[model samples]
Target: MPYWRLSAYYFCYFAFVGAFSPYFTLYLKALSFSATDIAVLMSLMQVMRVLAPNLWGWLAEHLGVRLPIVRLSALMSLAGFSVFFFTDSFAGIFLGMALMSFFWSASLPLIESVTFAHLGTQGHRYGSVRAWGSVGFIVAVIGLGVVLDWLPIMAVLWGTASVLASIFLCSLAVPEAVRPLAHSASASLGDTLRRPEVKALLGACFLMSAAHGAFYVFFSILLVDHGYGKAMVGGLWALGVVSEILVFMFMPRLMRHYSLRAILLFAFSCAVLRFALTGWGVASAALVAFAQVLHGATFGAYHAAAIAAVNRWFAGRLQARGQALYGSLSFGAGGMLGGLVSGLGWETIGPAWTFTLGSGFALAGLLWLVWGWQPGLGEDGTDRPDGGGR
Candidate 1:
């Protein structure tokens, strides 16, 4: 695999997200959207994510055409995003985000599976290549933050659009890896999902991620209201991504030292703690800044472990579908639930208590996996390499 090209692909792709995630709310506000309206619109993207990835995965698997699907989706995402520039009406924005997310999400799981397919058992090093994405995210967040401080929020969108275009160009540079054919060493999804352990792992991920809704939907507004300037907000967000990048730089080492079970447990525990601090620490920049660093464990480690778990749990043609399942269940359903609940709680209770609820969810997920998950050894059903890395 040409890792530099693949990593460049991720960096450009995620740079768009870093810009979009933090500023889209501001854009909605500029278009005269209410808080609830912004939340709903943002949640719609998560909805598409839930509905689209599995279908795309199934298609990619059956057709054996993962690269074309990725490229086409990137192109469509660029086109769909243009709709926002023409009209800011609720229906227009909703339709546009739906179209973009539906296609935008079609690519990642397949790309992940493809990258790992190219790497085989050496997959743990996925982090080293992937960490470039975190760097891109940091640069975008802080750069746009400063830009937004002086310019219109709409400029952020344009900036993000340029980045997405760059991602499309980079996608073209990623040479496709040969995927295993449908007939090769197959285990159907039915066979994979039938196992109690797989179900339990998915369940844990869904519950914990769903719990994180409060922070995602309202964290920025909460900080802004707390008197932090746009630059400070951007800096704090970059701090989190910086930590994530650092972890990715060392993720293979982390995997080598820990079991998948241990990694999951630690990641969720960090979420439990991070959200608790973030929810109530609005008055303390230091507290919030420190909490942001936990992104390393909460998101970085957890995601890497989850993908590795998916890689191990499914073989051959089922790989793409497996990664999709993990994304749909966790980021999809989990994201919507979190946004909805946070929107509700932000108006009624407050940011602090809403985040407390997020911690509860992570804690529940941690507990579930700690007790319910036990992998069936390996192909030999014996102790393996801890299923640690690529």
Candidate 2:
């Protein structure tokens, strides 16, 4: 099944994410970009995700060859990122971030589709494999934080480029999984998306992610402003991912007893609490640490459950496009709006209030789900008396 090859792609890909997510704004801040400007550029990254994945998904689903497209996308991501090495000017860096994000965003949804195919009937074990990406994120975030203690903050670019290069190399080792033929009665993409269940799911996903905008863009900066060291900031970031990894490890068990609906509801509820604690508890390290622990629910459980839900909702020929839609709508649209609004909030109301605003989005999602979401089965409708661990 080329499992390690697939795992390598995830590992390298998220290692790049780890280096960027917690640290990139610090780099931009060092470059003298305003908080609003930083928010725009960061949101620019999400904006690319909105369009690029669907574009790649159409090509992959139509062309019938996923690996070649994945390889090309990885290579192009590296090329797009290289412009950062030569120029740090706002215009150049902005273009570089946008271009790099376009190709980079194209990789994940396609890779997710491929992973689900490889898992076949054992899809519940997705967390075990995905945990490696969290591991990679922890490693990069912590290691680079230590490195930045002595080196220049711009060193993040070098680390990020290295990981992107590894992603390209890893893509070379993996082959495409065989997709099932479309059933004669399979619904069209438009029709599937039109379903009430689908709309509610996507809308909830969007609002939940939008709630994360302030944290993803400014969490580290906020900590720094509160007198936390870069190393401590990295530790806090790793703590969240470490909790996420633990959740991923136990997801099979959780899914066995709980519906996707429950897991998602739990995630939304945790997010509301997590962001608020983060906003108001900045002066209390223990309180902040407790909030970070909720990341296990917010991102880890929520994402795994959402992916599994999307996998169940879209099968066969609709696989790639369905996954792409999840990314485009949630991370792309949700994240962009979050970043933009958080920027305004950060500039006007301040960080604590801005994060409180995030909590409001999550609360909105939780309420929406309670009103709309119904219980559902595992993707294939199989209850695993024996969990799918392989």
Residue-wise C-alpha lDDT for candidate 2, range 13-90, written one tens digit per residue: 889989999999999999999999999999987898899999999999889878888898899999989999999899
TM-score for each model: 0.94, 0.96
lDDT of each: 0.82, 0.89
lDDT of 2 at 109: 94
The CA lDDT at 298 in model 1 is: 87
TM-score top scorer: 2
lDDT of 1 by residue, 40-111 (tens): 888877787798999999898788788889999999999999998998799999989888888998888888
Residue 300 error, candidate 1, Å: 0.7
TM-score of 2: 0.96
Q: Report residue 226 deviation for candidate 1 (angstroms).
A: 1.1
Off by over 4 Å in 2: 376-390
- For candidate 1, which ten residues in a row score worst on lDDT? 381-390
User: What's the true lDDT of residue 262 in model 2?
Assistant: 91
Q: What's model 1's TM-score? A: 0.94
